[model samples]
Target: MSRSRKVTLRAHPHGPTPGWAEVDTPPPAPDSTAAAFFDVDNTMMQGASIYWFARGLAARNYFTTGDLIRFAWQQLRFRVLATERSGDMSQAREVALAFIEGWRVEDVQRLAEEIFDELMAPRIWAGTRRIAQRHLDAGERVWLVSAAPVEIGRVIAARLGLTGAMGTVAEVVDGSYTGRLVGDLMHGPAKAEAIIQLAAVEGLDLSRCTAYSDSANDLPMLSTVGRGVAINPDAVLLREARQRGWEVRDFRSGRRAVKIAVPSTAAAGLVAGAVTAGLALHRRRQRVS
Candidate 1:
């Protein structure tokens, strides 16, 4: 289940995005028995990888501007609220799965690889990455546990040279997606369950493992490990981490209070700008056609 791939970061070909860096660490020795689990959104990267993937699809005209707007709104809520509600999860599951209903497994995988290099790679938080690298340096297996499609998670893990990844599995038949999930989304308690199952298969001891996340939704996953680190935690997770004496690492520069308050408005503005541009581009294309 865990396999290591060598990753070497080169100069950014698509210009700069925030938090990009080149790691100079030597190769890991793989001496440790314990492993580390990392949450994807906000913890490993600055934003939702799935949203970025959707944006890429939208650019390729795979979906309409309206579809992108809806996804952008959901992603904004995800970033601002930082809490995973059942309704939100259900809606996200539907939206995420519906878009790729008939996509070939290989085609989606190829797009995911392109999306990672173009959008996801630049958004990676340098601080969180350094921590992941430290675990790699110590020779412990590292896996990205995400609610995103497993294909996206695997791309990220492979790009970062992690041991592997676990994510929501979208069912496929005859090499094409069926637009349905195999089980529940790999989120909240489901994340913990996946880790527990993986541990058993990989001969890992939960008592010696560590998990990192940004949301209180992952409290189940965090508690499942011996050491839990909250990376840029939301207000709820921050409070919980303090009470539980879990390690907290905040890489954001602003005052803690500002971090919580600003995301809603800031992210909303970003989505609005994107929608405006998308609409304008759509209109132009329509006029030309």
Candidate 2:
């Protein structure tokens, strides 16, 4: 039987009003197959998921406006330089984790699903979603691979009717976060590594699998698969795409595609906020916890 479409909105035990739904997806297991993997932020959607989550947290009084600004700056730095250049991504990741030090894991998951369905869902590129659907129609498992927390990734997959997702793992103690990561944030090389592991576990044929992303930060992920498609590529990535002769689809090619990213800046503006928030968090970490 398919997953139930009915969503039950209720107050979470963690003291938040979030809509929860029964999840029917099984974790990855040994299975021979071909799959399509898509990056979530700036690839399938117009902006970063973490950015919006942070905004949600801000609205909930988790942090201040200055915190969000500092966060955005760091995220922008990590996104712009991590793939093409050597720079520590942990600087951005640590603060993002610390931003929700005492948050309950279940609460974040519920909130992410609700926020995505209400705010970020329409922000997802129709063209990108259509591409994923085509893969699903072809009987391929579609997974959303992203640096965002695995919870957010799964929410995106479930909402989009995809198979599964792979994302950065955050550490939790009991039901609350420990403000730490279990491993490297799923960025740059980490994304490739995660896919490799997933492929092995699922017995997937990498030679027949396809991967898609929009940033050079995802170069490793885009290159690891047999087929790589660049969607809404920036100038740098577009240049690389041309050099590699990889297929590319510019969702920003016209005003029509711009609707998915209304004001187009909504996603970008939030992403830029990650950097500012990260910086602020870093400074705070220096003086306090």
Candidate 3:
């Protein structure tokens, strides 16, 4: 005969766990924390965060009119580029990283906040925001996980009034970016890894936590949590959700749906081409060094 062991779950300070008892699980462990991890792109905001930040820089003249045109082109490809082959995501992201080479870290943080308020504020989806708020009201810790720079993610989390966030942390030297990543960008398996590390540090119970995202790229992360929710899912993610019987929420189906306004595809294509070149050049420099 097998003996059963009991486990305990810790409730969030906001209130008692909602429907937690419905599940046949022991009480939470002492000091255990339940959290909600959210994806930043299509999952939260209607579009990509980098694009809006670039647009904000253009409007502020940080990037000249001509520079803005090129950047927009790159962002377009960044948004629509499909990754069929292995390492494709990494190669594509290297483009954005090259763009930020030699920028001061503090400057980026300050600018992200300004840009987020002016441009990103209006793009937040109410349905997704409601989910985040519900978790917050329940006193559960909430975090924004994305491949966008960490500073940008933190700003978004603060604005949303959540606990905190985690994102891609770029390598910095002498107060400026080195154009090299400190670790893997927070995507796919990397996101799951990040959450696992967080759980160890925060004493979170993965089986009692929740994760939300829209891209199939985030499947690894969604699978890591006990409850996975799909918001405004892309075709790939929607299919996976159906197969897994995961909960789905779509905020973009109605005529009143609003997303962040971006530039033309042609403009974004130009920017993508430039970014491709920039990545090649940056790689060459690294080889030479």
Candidate 4:
């Protein structure tokens, strides 16, 4: 089983507003056997949630501008290029874990709550939020499945009035972050494994469930469910969705919906390389000091 943690839904202290408004349409009868799983980045939201969180922390002076730039570049690559290689995933995990090492879990959760409202809330896709709300209206459980830290995922899920969330587990010891993951990242094939275990525990029928995502990296997860939706999918996922007859939703405008051309991608790659070198130099200077 993947080391994804399942968080139970709870009311937020600030009483978060739902992304979608209340509809006059009557809700359907409860469907206890079915559920909907949604991916976070580029699916339910406009960009990477973690990148926003990192930006928020940067605003609070938690890290240097160089660190935030590195994060931003990584998110850009992930969002536009759909780069999800094993090495990239490993590097992201290490950077995130190291940054939070020795921090209190509760403190991180509190900051995540604030950051979600300030940064994440505005970025949520209205169309995707409506789809999730539709599942809720039908009395089916809705869960955000993400590779983000479980605490961050839970905040998003709770704020959106979803059932809960399944996300990557970061180990904690004595109420503080250990800077180590409990298992692997809750991504790619691991996401499929996590939900399979969750279904067994929650009595959900796999065939009755639906999964939504924006990346081809989630092929395992999208394939596991009965219905697969591609929301603002990358070129690879878009092609696969067309070939597989999966439902596709594009909230972006015609100009924005076009795939990033090779020139833009190559330029972004060059910028990322520069930012990465700067971040490395910054880290080296800190160590030297």
Candidate 5:
């Protein structure tokens, strides 16, 4: 007999109404594999979604070239040191809102469509995509979790054909940007909470699912899954992952599934050249002697 799936929509106490569906828990299918959750930024790509936002804003002409220059400078300073300055985040929010303040929602979505193909697709990690495909091919659901605004996350979800996406919900009023976020930011524990809620609605058993990430900030969400994998994890996260016995994968090109060797492919060419030069010198010395 076929299993019935149920969906539930729950109201947000402090934010815009979020629609969610609750599923009646069902027995695992004979062919069903575990679901996989992915952290979108560093784990799946080389940088953060904010970087893409800068490009997106420029494409829409929402920001002047000068504005982009300022944004780039801030991005370089804050992210390089891995510091979360509240002032920086606030400033970022302000700039982001100003860019889309009066833009029609439809226009923004259309622009997202273009940005997804141009900026996001080619930059996505091949190993990450392979892992996502492995789960999908095994008949498991895939979710994209990020701290980016819901609208931006939705665009990425659509591009990847994912089952759903959970992200920070920026506040909007009367179909215009409100320059503030609604509810809790979808990060750390909030991310774990969202995943649990999503799983409950889909009748998914958390113990049978998997999650992948690259930072310690995602610990809560990663811990929620039965199998958590750390991909190209940061220093702190690498130690934590090892302690917790979590599966780990290196996303750099030509990197072995084991320890993160220097980014291969490009580095390999340099090594080969050095070895060839060393051999040539040794042969010349032998002939001279």
Candidate 6:
């Protein structure tokens, strides 16, 4: 009794690109009984998950402001290059872990909770959230899948009360980050592979599953599912979505829920309420210098 809806956003291209060209995609199935997969970065949020994570780290002093600025610039440059090669994926991981050295697994998890409301909530596409809720209301599983780290995924899933989430996992030992991923990056072809493996583990049928994405890079995941809906897809994906007759939509003009930013004081309170030793840890680090 559930159906998929394509929620598109107006693409904002920085640098020399000016803007993204219009795209035409296919229609989706009239009705479907399947789980829906959501891409976390541009698809679910306003921008990249890694970018937000870097900002959060910088705010907490885990990363310096300059480090975060460089990280953001690197991301911008990478998008401009438009390369989907796996080597780029490897390099991204190294960059992410380099700044997170010496961070306790628990502290990051605690900060993720604060940012979940401050940063993550506002970035979720309204149309996408509605579609996901519709499926959940109909008793279908709604999973948030992403290449972002597991802590980031968990924060989002918990906030939304989602059934589950699948994301990149970093190696951890003795309650600290090893700064290394235990497996292949969860992107491009790897995303599709994760879905297939998840289906086997969760006893779900791939032929009955649905996936929603905004980028051509997610083709492997979109193609693997029985139902694929492209939401404001990229040029390359728009052509493929049209060929496959997948549903596409542009939700930029629609009315959306207003998101209020949690004030710095409120965020500090939340962090304090979540952990008694939060401020102590910050002070302790200062005294060591």
Q: What TM-score quantifies how close candidate 6 is to the native fold?
A: 0.71
lDDT of 6: 0.67
lDDT of 4 by residue, 150-234 (tens): 9989999999999999898888999998878888788899899999999999999999999999988899999999999999888
Better of 1 and 3 by TM-score: 3
Question: In model 6, how large is the Cα lDDT of residue 202?
Answer: 74
TM-scores for candidates 1 onward, in order: 0.74, 0.74, 0.75, 0.75, 0.68, 0.71
lDDT of 2 at 72: 52
Model 2: lDDT equals 0.75
lDDT of 5: 0.67
Question: Candidate 1, residues 81-199: lDDT per residue as tens digits?
Answer: 54435645665565446546666899989999998899889978889999999898887899999987899999999999998999989899999988788888897899999999999
Q: Report backbone clashes per prediction.
A: 0, 22, 16, 0, 8, 1
TM-score, structure 3 vs. true: 0.75
lDDT of 3 by residue, 101-218 (tens): 7778888789999999999989888899999988877678889998877888999999989888898888899999877777787878999999999999998999889999988889
**What TM-score does model 2 achieve against the real structure?**
0.74
How do the residues 1-289 of candidate 6 rate in per-residue lDDT, one tens digit apiece?
A: 7654554545566655546655545445433346778887656766666555545644666534343333444444543443535455656565434333456899879888887777778878788888888878766788888877778888888888787888888788888877677787677888899988878877777888889887787999999999998875667888999999999864544333112122111332223222223333444677799
For each candidate in the order shown, give its overall lDDT on alpha carbons. Answer: 0.78, 0.75, 0.76, 0.78, 0.67, 0.67
Q: Which stretches of candidate 3 lie over 4 Å from their true place?
A: 1-31, 68-82, 88-93, 255-289
Candidate 4 overall lDDT versus native: 0.78
The ten-residue window of minimal lDDT in model 3 covers 259-268
Query: Which consecutive 10 residues in model 6 have the weakest lDDT in total?
Result: 256-265
Between candidates 3 and 6, the one scoring higher on lDDT is 3
Q: Over 4 Å off in model 2, which ranges? A: 1-32, 66-87, 254-289
